[model samples]
Target: MESQESHRIVVTLAQKARDGADAQQLADFIVSSWQTIEASLSPIIGQRSVATLYKRSFYLASREHPWLMDMHEGMQTTVNLAALKAALLERTSAEIAAGAGAALQMFYEALTNLIGASLTERLMRSVWADLFPVPTQENSA
Candidate 1:
């Protein structure tokens, strides 16, 4: 269901991750991160060129977005990732001054699309999971 709350949900998950949350929360963050990407870019880039746009956006976004930077480092890029990132990442002075957060969010979504969510989910489990300890009764105590 689309949101009807009349207010957008900003990335609280990033701050949560920074503060050290549980694996479930991290998983939520991961899913939300992809959602941020899709929601931001899918309309503008469209389906036909989405993959290309994702690559371009991921590369560009990773440069500025801290949360995305982690995912970007682990990504296995091809020549296409390089060329596309370069070509499409040239934002105007006004666009940059306005802030690159929106662009980075779209690109991060593109990275997930480029890499496939399954692989990214696996990575989250294997890599990012350690950053946040899974909550247990013991930990809660």
Candidate 2:
């Protein structure tokens, strides 16, 4: 079992990892760290709900725009986990910010590919659309 603080740090690092690190590196980190996040949230949310929330968040985050699309383009890149862990430990906010967008794109791509497009699309549509409500035909018509 992982500590909550460690999980939070991992989540933050995973978010940063998406900024500029290699897609595979970020993907691997997400995969490993997911257990921590899941564990941390499990008691509060229940396993199924926590899993669903994670899927939704990842889907929505990944599909926000073209950067993520580009990230998906290189989804097969293998991550050097040691290097990634080091980068997460040492990388600055500016550096992270610079590559974070692209990393997130890649993360989304990897996730969508692993999880399937339909599920990813449904998660994105349900979670993100609620936050940033797309105008419906009723509104336009």
Candidate 3:
């Protein structure tokens, strides 16, 4: 439950962190960004409960991996700006939705590059394993 101002701070911190800025400055920026995104998405998700999900998905993901977090923040900002333009250009909801999906796909690509494809895949696998605790193929056999 952070305020919009706090979220902006997180975003600023993330940006600064990417640029090799001071740790304190970067920390403040990230806090602000986290707060802002939370505030903006709160209404759209139709409940405060969604905040936890977003925090885990977006904030936590970024925080745990500094490089990924920086890339994601930058990609999200670009994607959001593009989304605004797409919404304006498209007359139909379908077109707008399509544009948004495209933007998301592009963001995923950016994320992949940020973490490096191999590392990103490994990170995802690890996360999945942490959640599911599935046995390996060799163990199963």
Query: In terms of lDDT, which candidate is strongest?
Result: 2
Residue lDDT tens for model 2, 48-81: 5554444343335445432322322322223233
lDDT of 3 by residue, 6-88 (tens): 23323332333345554333333333433443454445443343333432344344443333232234332222323233322
Inter-residue clash pairs, candidate 2? 18-103, 19-99, 19-100, 20-99, 68-105
- The global Cα lDDT (0 to 1) of model 2 is 0.42
Q: Candidate 3: misplaced stretches above 4 Å?
A: 1-15, 58-141
For candidate 1, which ten residues in a row score worst on lDDT? Answer: 1-10
In order, the Cα lDDT scores of the candidates are 0.39, 0.42, 0.35
Write down the TM-score of every candidate.
0.30, 0.33, 0.30
Q: Which is the better candidate, 1 or 3, if ranked by lDDT?
A: 1
Off by over 4 Å in 2: 1-21, 65-141
Candidate 3 lDDT (Cα, 0 to 1): 0.35
Name model 1 segments beyond 4 Å from true: 1-11, 32-45, 62-141
All candidates: CA RMSD in angstroms?
Answer: 12.8, 13.5, 18.3
Error of 3 at 47 (Å): 4.3
